[model samples]
Target: MWVQRVIELTGWEPLGVSVDWAVVEGELGVPLPADYKELYEAFGGGVFSDSVYFLGRDEGVSFDFLAQWRVGLSVDQDGKFGDVSAVDPYAIYAPGGKGLVEWTPPNGPTSTSG
Candidate 1:
């Protein structure tokens, strides 16, 4: 409903392909909101309103959430922004730890745990 309204208002086009939610959730390790899923299903992944860019799922590509998360971890590991611990307060070292965790409701506040 809301997604349709927004799409109608913004004139955004659908991706014309169904997404594999199970794989996506497995990769992210979190359940995405229905609205977000709907939006992604409607628009795929691309820039919206000239400011927002939704991350799309692409096998073996760097556009998916896992890839983007890895990029962040890599940047932190390289200490490009100084000490990793100092830079990433909420980061959960997944190599031998509990792994990173992020929880968010539909357009609600987010909670993170390592």
Candidate 2:
């Protein structure tokens, strides 16, 4: 939760969070700069960008400035949780920037991953 708080205090908003932050791809996670945490909920973000199905570059994110689709995620300091499932544009205010999530009707929980 400390990680999430640090992100929010810095003014970044969380997009969504996966069940497990540890499960995020290593390559994609490794390249994130130190400031990445500052933009995460740990700083001040309210969104949850930790979902396994996050909608950003798989290789990495533009740490310098947030892209139109980039977002963050975090559990509150009290242990409460939040996600971006119902949020618009994930975190950005652009159109069609949420990418293409292939929903599989009402039967499968696993939607097609791009």
**Candidate 2 lDDT tens digits, 15-96:** 4422222333242333333344333423323335664332332234532123323333322122343333424444534466
- On lDDT, the candidate that comes out on top is 1
TM-scores for every predicted model: 0.59, 0.19
User: For candidate 2, which ten residues in a row score worst on lDDT?
Assistant: 69-78
Q: By how many angstroms RMSD does model 1 differ from the true structure? A: 9.0
The residue-by-residue lDDT of candidate 1 on 4-96, one tens digit each, is 998899887766547788877775566777788887788776665986668757564544766776677666774453434324455655556
Model 2 bad stretches (over 4 Å) = 1-22, 25-29, 43-114
C-alpha local distance difference test of each model: 0.67, 0.37
- Using alpha carbons, what is the TM-score of model 1? 0.59
- Model 2 residue 110 CA deviation (Å) reads 29
Candidate maximizing TM-score? 1
